[model samples]
Target: MRHFWCILLAIAILPGFCQALDIKGVHYLSLQEVAGKLGMKTRWIQQDKTMQLESAWTKISFEVNKRDMTLNGTRIFMGYPIVASRGRFYLSESDYDHNIKPILTPQLSGAPPGLRHIVLDPGHGGKDPGAENKSIGLKEKALTLDLANRVKSKLQARGFRVTVTRGNDTFVSLENRAQNANRLNADLFISLHFNASSTTSVSGVETYAFTPNLQPSTSRSSLHSSDRKTYPGNARDEWNTLAAYYVQRSLFTSLKARDRGLKRARFTVLRDIRMPGILVEGGFVTNNTEGRNIGSASYRDKLATAIVDGILVYKKTLDRLAK
Candidate 1:
């Protein structure tokens, strides 16, 4: 383990790493400098307080003081909001390491993981019905199970080994869910779920990976002492970011739904997982329209297709990197 960290430290100080500025003790990198290092040309939209970096294969847009950014048109939330000082915008080094570097320059982040076996976890079952919309008769547990089965079928058809945390409406502890995957020696883990909100109008799809050490999750604006803690799942932080990004992008594009953006969270299942994993909030079960949509078999099939597509894309990315 000490040797592993030593190698990571060596990589962090490489030329590709940003020149960091100490801002309230957090390290940050100038947006312009980041763009230059990535071989992207920067353009500022002063009126909108947005800066865009474009290159032959990538386009990223960052807004001053915002945690959400667009990478090649996919919405993703940074660990910290962009900081502005002396007419310049800066991104947290944590964001660069966990989000940007993994997506744009994955090879430098680390070696790509094998993509052969996958474990699909349906979020809740049995007594844990999870989120529900009684008005529309939609239950998150049932929807997740259906979606997981659909995804499993599609994945198996594409020649990948797949396992499910549960085959029916049976309760499985969160820790057991992850441990099952580890025991199976799965290459990837995906937990499927539906969302709900007190506000009925709130609706969208979002994906979550384990939060990087010392970085706040998407829902939090400030870091907490607990943010410094690392877990077994953090071992695959780079791959988690990459997988979540692709899955979120594919879902938004195929479903034509609101892009909630790829997010970070320390969910129990994610924190205990031994391999790259993400928990997907497919949509809101409480939203009137979306709730009805989740009840439909065709929409569920589409969601499965989009998810399978994303996994294929991620696999292709790793394959390309290996060569």
Candidate 2:
């Protein structure tokens, strides 16, 4: 069987400690193998069908039959459920490659990436109001701009050159947004938006990076079109993924909202970015409870603060990688 050959190939090629298992023609690695790579301590809780991986600063918990795991209390999707084999738990090869590696070991590139200049995009402007919550009269455009102003101020305090694509209630096309950032020679690009769902109950923070080449987006509906192209944005896919995670975690801490997990999309703003880029949908505007929060000045300030906190973590990681 092809699967059997894959298992043989993995064992023959990988270091002895890996203990790789092939499942359905793909390889998965054992908890011990992953723990060794990440320098984390692993505890197997057989009764609860859980494995806890802890490091000096964080603890991550994974459970069988679940596609999602908790990273230091912030929920992150694994892209596929981890399975148990002969009392050892395994992480899917795709999940480890597309999800875990980027978040934990981001700077795989020989040269380190920096975040010296940041471009903040306030999604939808003059002509395009984007999603809106009619009950509270909150338009997505105004909210994003307000949040961008605060974020710009925050980033400036952190010693980064910060600029927004739109300074007022003006329209800026997606291509223009990317071009503006490129023109500025930005080191990072962050596009901000407020989400809306048809279902009123849906509310959470979602962060997105351009889908990697030969990979599908997190949402199934996007698969067909996403298969069409890859871009320069893929150059620093690892950095983009880690940056998204840092901000997603910080947003959870500041907003106390649901962690929707880091996602992949073929967003125009991201696809053409020569530098690392991410888009943040802070929360759903359609949800009445969250709509009010998104409309508040205090909440906008917190959003800015969360972004700054995330960027700080990302910069620190870059510094460590450079050394």
Candidate 3:
């Protein structure tokens, strides 16, 4: 039954009209290889004691009290323990997001200290079934995860460190979600979310970033200014000012979806994060045509590819600016 569903999800990513992505040479590490590469040994400590391993110049440990885990003495709350699979300790993708990646990659860089750690948050999970596309019988949570996973795969292939908020159909709170990003000091926080309208007439793709340090009224006024300037409109008018300018732009080219234009708004997830953050409203699930497309494996794959392209573009812009 699960395999049947997996196949369906895989099919949905192939958006028929879009060009296929070049996804070659993506290497994922096994738990033991990940541990061994760092010169750490995995031990099954049955006592109330902690299990610690040293790797990549970082010391990692699992706490006996609760699921609390840490690396380099920094605390990370894991909802699940690292499991041993095939004689090696394997960390679930979701667990890696909350526990391992936080300590491994804390900065965003283009081949500097290392590849940037990205947090791909699939908004609305478990009981909170975000928007529903009745036409296709697709739940927003399912679509979000499907796209997030695909994005993760493509990015991994392209040599970027990626993390996902929810790996399965489980509930995760906003606070915890933000905390994961905060703890990791993520280079970027990209939240995957689909739109829904009661009228079913609305459809388009929009990206959002939190208002700058300025007050809401002031920001709103600036957004409405005759200059026609938009969000992240800095005094210097820097490139990609909307926080996701390049990403949103690249996405439009890849997905060929409606361009709703980037905007500024107060969202709980984006506001508190320190790094550059953007929330992607892919399309409206309420609209019949879009709902079905969102439910398809091919389209979801394109969506994921579009997102990965955006991130790569953002990285290139950052590198140029840094130089």
Candidate 4:
């Protein structure tokens, strides 16, 4: 009988239903607000299987489940589990779209939110010749700048605001790189470089985060225990951990590159920056074959996409963890 009455009530309300009002912010409406909007009274019965709402000439009873919600004794599907937050029932966007749209006229197409600003730092410039491969004549500084530009473009397309440390051929100091990030309040920092080795066979991608204990000398010669040149403490540690986990994972998954799991070391940009910073050794420029591949425009674009995807994945994980 409850189911039958709910069906009748739904039919009565169907013809006069108006489009849903715009929902602002990132929160859901309360049940009382939902009832008032729908012109129905809602009640909670002590029995787990049944609920009652009395308003106007109708009384409705429905059963609530972990994955489903029944209204007027009618079973309704839910996209995610029903959650109660702050003493109010909450449903995801899926539930609102699938279950409520038939009765509510206004519908919105879902678009993912844009990411916060990203700071791209091209490693080495001017006097700094990071690495060189004879075969393709790829210089680490030039390649890093090119790759950084490509990454900036791709990230822009994916709705991320992008800024580069050096737009052209001029060199930017390590201090300026971190300062730029601080000025922009960037969310992610990526520094691009290519690796070199005495052995020509070394090839693969490696990502580094910040480590207070692993601070190396400015010349990369020997450990400077007494240098007293260490910058601030692990200010960027949290961001680096997130960056390392997401970037390293995404790079290997998409590019099928070797996994050089997250490592910590003293990279000026990573250590001084206030945000999550990562330095990417795209591939071994010392390797004959890998240098050729890194020089290609197509491969650079793929690499950019991988980095962007990693940022997105990290963003999602952060969102989930925040809840």
The residue-by-residue lDDT of candidate 4 on 1-323, one tens digit each, is 43355346556774222212122222344445566655777677754444455566544343443544543323333334444432344444434443443223121322222248888999989887779877678888888888898888878887778899988777789988988887898877889888899999888876776653333322343345633355542554444555565676677668877664445567678767776677887888888877788888888778878887888877776555444
Please give the TM-score that candidate 4 achieves against the real structure: 0.59
- Per-model TM values vs. the true structure: 0.93, 0.87, 0.58, 0.59
Q: Give candidate 3 misplaced runs (Cα > 4 Å).
A: 1-115, 215-243
Q: What are the per-residue Cα lDDT tens digits for candidate 2 across 44-159?
A: 75554999988998677889877778777767665457788656788877677767777776665457787789999999999999999998999999999999999999889879
Question: How well does candidate 2 score on lDDT at residue 101?
Answer: 79
Instruction: Give the TM-score comparing model 2 with the true structure, all chains together.
Output: 0.87
Q: Rank the candidates by lDDT, best first.
A: 1, 2, 4, 3
Best by lDDT: 1
Better by lDDT, candidate 2 or 1: 1
Clash total of candidate 3: 11
lDDT by residue (tens digit), candidate 3, 1-323: 43354345556873221211111211123344456544676555543355566655877676443344555543433433444322333344434432354234323222321227888999999999999976579799989998899999999998888888889999998778877887887777788999998988888787765543322221243222332322322221122232355556656667777766555455667655656677888888999888888888999998888888877766765565466
Instruction: Assess candidate 3 and give its lDDT.
Output: 0.61
Candidate 1's C-alpha runs over 4 A off are: 1-20
lDDT of 1 by residue, 1-323 (tens): 43355346656774333344576678888787888789898888664499988998998999988999999889999888988754567888888888999999998967899999999999999999999999878888899999999999999999999999999999999999999999998999999999999999999999998999999988898888889898999999999999999999999999999999999998999998889999999999999999888899999999999999999999999999988
- Model 2 accuracy (lDDT, Cα): 0.83
Q: Give the TM-score of candidate 3.
A: 0.58
